[model samples]
Target: MPSDVRRTTLLTVAVLVWTLAGCRTVNRGLTEAVLDGEHARQWHIRYGSQSFYSLGDEGLAKIEFEGLIDRERVRVRYQRGMQGQAECVADVTTRLIEQVELRVGMTITTSTTIDLLRFDEPPQNFDIQLTVEPNEFPLPLFVRAGDESCTSILAQNRSYPYVLMHELVETSLAARAGGRVLPDVGYGWFGLGGSVNNYTRWFRDGLANYAGYLACEILSDEMDCPECPTRVAPLLHTSPLSRLATVRTRLFSWSQSSPSEHEREHYNAALGLFLLIEDRFGQQTIRDILADVATRETVDGRDLRAIASQVIGTDVKQFVADFEFPMIGGVLTPVTRALAANKGLNVAEGLLLEFVEPDGPADRAGLRPDDVIVAAASAPVADTIDFELALLRAGRPASIPLAIWRKDAGTIDVEFPLLYPGKD
Candidate 1:
């Protein structure tokens, strides 16, 4: 919640006050400061909402750059040249944003702004700052993390695309909800506050982080969040990936309200609940849940639990309880010590299907009893843990791929349909 709260968009008034101090301001490569009076006036007119207001004269050097991705426009304003990132950062970040939009079946067409700020002295020294206004202005994107500039972050983190996507997706959803359901949340990126906006912190961050990881996974062929994904390191000891859901996602008494301390990495719980939903219903259900949030303006405001439950035709509280998510499903076994020796597998080279329930996910994927899964989701599975980890990273899919070694068929690939619990 604190990490998400760092996005508090005090950009406007903060910049105004800082610039008004009238000395030791950033003049590095900033076009605004050197513009002639008339052009400066016109320049301020165009971008004054970004806090370039009331500057009669000053010296600052900044960078102006723009790019398009998947037909959406992106603009970046910076106090220093991005060096090489200036060429590809916007395109990469915008594409990640586009992926999140496409995944949710929604598109926020508003142009986005990325601010790369560096404060060299006083009140803040050697720090990074973000500035933006989505509703008040068209720039709905801002990212702040420690003292690293956005460009610096990109250069340092290969997974920076995920960070950019997280900010954009969260802001976009906030904008859509603000524009529609919670009109009282005010305009601009600051629209993320209110009774309803309380949902913005944990749940919103979770969903955004989930969406961002998905996009990152798709682009990189793996989920590459340096600090995340490891939260799932405890390769599930639960049922098989081919199991049936014994419990359904129906609303319960406890889910009537959204809990504030609901911080089990909303990302983790959400990923579980949603993947279960995806396995049971379909991936389309995930899109439906988000779409419902964006365009929905019910009497209860934008309640995620209700919206997800409604979409999944069940409830959301099950996952919220102590941040617990069901890992219940079918079962797989590590190639037994004897079996590994018999099969010449040195280090848990594969998993054996102990029981593939008839008409279950395994059966639907053409898995049969005694089958050996050598790989899952394109990764080699050396044990039950590997297979489960693969399944976890793959999320829930109707047709996740599996490669198995059958006594009769050798190594063959199968498009496994991962169904969830409930024959319903």
Candidate 2:
């Protein structure tokens, strides 16, 4: 009898241990499921100052989450705030998830005084799936090229994916919507320090891959021929600023003396060559072409320039001349240094004359048009004299600094570190 009792006790203990382990596993799964659900149902919102280049005075965002619980009650809650202000609205609960979403929408307006710049498309609704009591984590979902979808992780964690997707979609869509036909042709605008910065952010959040990123980097300034389909486009290219550096010298000349109609036509022709290569060849081919060109190798018994001539039946110089057109207005101008005569440095005639020079110290320093000069060499010059003083002060050799104000954009305080001037 005692032996029978001992055996029964052992069996009961074993069963209890197994049941406890199962319960723990179920509990952990449930927690993860809940977290994911919270992430998915939340509408991740972000906005910037509507006008571009207003760095300091832009309104940040306040986040909120609204969702249904067990397919019945609606729950709305404020997730977080920025800069110590709690901008969230009063939380509300209801029986419908739709109502929860609506209520959350109402609170968004109250969070900011200025009209927030919203994404072209924001998630207005969610497709909820019902699962067992203990839910499981979902697999990674894929986004199509130029298309994006928000997941629970992005929504709940307040991840930057939503903002990044907006940029990607906006950029791709904007390029498509722009006058340019070939997608690669749009690469010129997208291949800049700014574009690369945004691209990196997008890649980190799983919005982009190697191809698009590299294309943007190589073609930032060559707006005429924007497309470049290559592994570089998807992969991060080392220098987004490469093209920008070369562009500075051309800026002053382009801006001061208008390109002759003939020259303009030539530049436009070159742009056309870019468009053709981008449209006909895949990104990999472009990469191969660039690699061959860089290494001074021959393809099919011809050098890069020669191969280009064979493929297009025209030399690089001729091809550039054919497509080149007069410099179009409204493109970004290269910046260069000008010292104030009395207070701010005067823009040197040469620097001012050049429309753009990509890497010139003046251009790299970010000077804009119609900027008033205030000081040079960190010294305040107050005497308001005639034109001679202004010109003389501008020529001073000490590394200059200037405070300038533009009409639309605000004032900028800048300094240019002088380098040994190359053969100018």
Candidate 3:
């Protein structure tokens, strides 16, 4: 065949193969191959490259990248197709290190690599999963994507920055302490074996949330006008003290509540406690606690309490006791009973409003603290459980009649609209 004819024939065959690949799963593999190479090379140059291999156990291949921040080489790795995201994460992380160091006035000598993963679809059972390699020198930090569609932009903005800062702070503490800092017990009762002994999930979570709040403040200020209000959102719907007061009963045992409740009540309670500590003792107290923990060879609930007491120059027991029981007489009791009795309100068969989130549907409907909820959607509201069930049964954004009894005012009826916070 002539040279031109031969060239034309080869081009036709290539186009046919490309067209066929476009219509099948094979196209994904081809595209991923191209992306993988491009991303690996880019990260390898931008952040120092370590190795390229399949994350054998994880069933994913990853490229490792490293960069220097304050004499520490921060490493980051990501699976294919998330190179840009990883780069953004790395940049944010570098800034976090500086912020943490400035706030704590401690150098983070420990080395760590942040691993990023993206999912095509949300996992059926899990949201995001973050793990830290406690024993490794250059600690391996794993960050996996959650259901992005389900997460609000506000939440993402708040949480992602917080997670980065929280991990860095924890890792920094671990580096100084010479090992992994055990999880917090939060509000676990004293005697439960596995239940009480397990690390307090809320402590770290609250700490992370606080860190996220701080990061938001920093970023917002950095990006905003000089006189603009702080960009960080409130950590909880109500005041920390109120949150702690309301959830006192549920704190004793993790098994008593669902995961969602744990996230809301316990985590917020923990954040509230930290906020209280910050309010009473100033920011240096937090630094002191972290520094003290770093020096300690081992840490436990008692150790943490002792550190808090030492730093604050007050009995940590009083704080715990206060959180567990906020009554004036030092009696440990549920907020419902305490409020009904103290306020001289009849509460034989009604859910007392311990809190009414500002601007929430309940608040918008004129609900207030100490108000007794008699009925919702014509159903008797005997307790919180009943109220919750009624709300669920009422479904989303339903305007239903609510019967409330006020001490000064007579029995009042109002239409309450049930709504989700971030949904509407």
Candidate with the greatest TM-score versus the true structure: 3
- Quote each prediction's TM-score: 0.44, 0.18, 0.45
Model 2, poorest ten-residue lDDT window? 106-115
In model 3, the worst 10-residue window by lDDT is 325-334
Better of 2 and 3 by TM-score: 3
lDDT of candidate model 2 versus the reference: 0.30
Compared with the true structure, the alpha-carbon lDDT of candidate 1 equals 0.49
Q: Taking the tens digit of each residue's C-alpha lDDT, what string does model 1 give over 143-214? A: 233444434444333334555556555555556545222222323456653332333333444455566556
RMSD of each: 21.5, 24.5, 19.9
Q: Cα deviation in Å at residue 135, candidate 3?
A: 5.9
Work out candidate 1's RMSD over C-alphas: 21.5
Comparing candidate 1 with candidate 2, which one achieves the higher lDDT? 1
lDDT (Cα, 0-100) at 98 in candidate 1: 67
Candidate 3 per-residue lDDT, tens place, 255-368, comes to: 323476456667556556666666667778887877787686777555766777898898665664454211111111122445677778775557666776676676777877
Best by lDDT: 3
Where model 2 places Cα greater than 4 Å from the true spot, the runs are: 1-53, 57-271, 278-285, 293-314, 320-424
Residues 1-424, model 2: lDDT tens digits = 6999999996687567658777677667667977878743567788744423121212222222222112122111222221111111111111111231232111110111111122333333323232212211111111222222222112221112222222232233213232111111112445552211111111111112222232233222222222212112121221122221223223112221233643333222222233334444434444444333334321221233464555444564454433211111112212223233432333321121124356565455575444444444444322211111232334435445655444455446776544442422
Clashes of each: 25, 71, 5
Which lDDT value does model 2 have at 416? 51
RMSD (Cα, Å) of model 3: 19.9
